[model samples]
Target: MRNAMTGLALLLALLLASGGAAGAADFPLAGTWTLTAADRITPAGVREPDYGAAPKGRLIVDATGRYSLQIFKSERTGFASGDKKRGTPQEYADAALGSSTHYGTIAIDAAAHQLVFRIEGASFKNWEGTTQRRAYDLKGDRLSYRVPTAPDGNVPVSEWRRER
Candidate 1:
């Protein structure tokens, strides 16, 4: 009887230590987050603002592991032709450089604490059908992550706050 009690105690202790007895939540990142700030840092320690000071964007992650994000500068000018489809080359170039959008599925690596985005479609032509791994942190209502460096040697960082 004493040996059985000792074994039971050991099992209980293991369960408590491993945190496996209380099942973990499945969807920790399922919510809408709005971008609060974005900045780019160069390898030479130069810092540049990204998407302007008061950028507008939304990031939505659904329970089904799908995600979409859009970020844009607030001061973008309207197309010269007053129509999106008829925008001149310069207007189209300005819009493309000033905004970003992507949608795809996300895979979380709990051990590594990183989110892998398997991008299906993106406004930036080069990013479509690409996979990007971003290290992320979630604290209270804030989420922050770093984007892979751009061709211009700038590393982008973005912070988002949960929407309600």
Candidate 2:
């Protein structure tokens, strides 16, 4: 009985020391972050990495609760001489890497633990209708989120590492 009580006390102490009964603060995401990953997920539960060739980017969040992103992609065009240089799956994915600039805002509902990301640009937009809003989760240096697939019943979940 004493051992069990001691173990339970330790567990409670650990939980309290780590910040008790509190959700992740919305203030935790207010900073500049580099794009460490970009993935395309399928409805069949497969995750394929889509960003390569140093897909660099920045996310800036201001004090008044406003944010914007300026991201860049290195142009990768393989030599064409019947060599099939840029025609492979990896090659094609690399070739499509180009400058994709987008700007957006981040909003979170403390009650629901949901993050709403609204992003827009000149040409493309996610099927979220206007802006790309998603429910997000943050753990240490990692951030993950899920955006519901277009008109379809699928969803894409992506994980990203924080840039130091």
Q: Backbone collision count in every prediction?
A: 0, 0
For model 1, the superposed segments whose C-alpha errors exceed 4 Å read 1-25
Candidate 1 lDDT over residue span 94-154, tens digit each: 7987899999998788798888899999998788999999888888889888898888889
Give the C-alpha miss distance for residue 8 in model 1, angstroms: 34
Q: Judging by TM-score against the true structure, name the best candidate.
A: 1
Instruction: In model 2, state the lDDT of residue 22.
Output: 44
In model 1, which range of ten residues has the least summed lDDT?
Answer: 18-27
Residue-wise lDDT of candidate 2 within 55-120, one digit each (tens)? 566666643346665444545556454476536675665544443445656777767787776664
State the local distance difference test value for candidate 1.
0.85
Worst 10 residues of 2 by lDDT: 120-129
Which ranges in model 2 have alpha carbons more than 4 Å from their true place?
1-26, 71-75, 78-99, 120-129, 150-158, 161-164
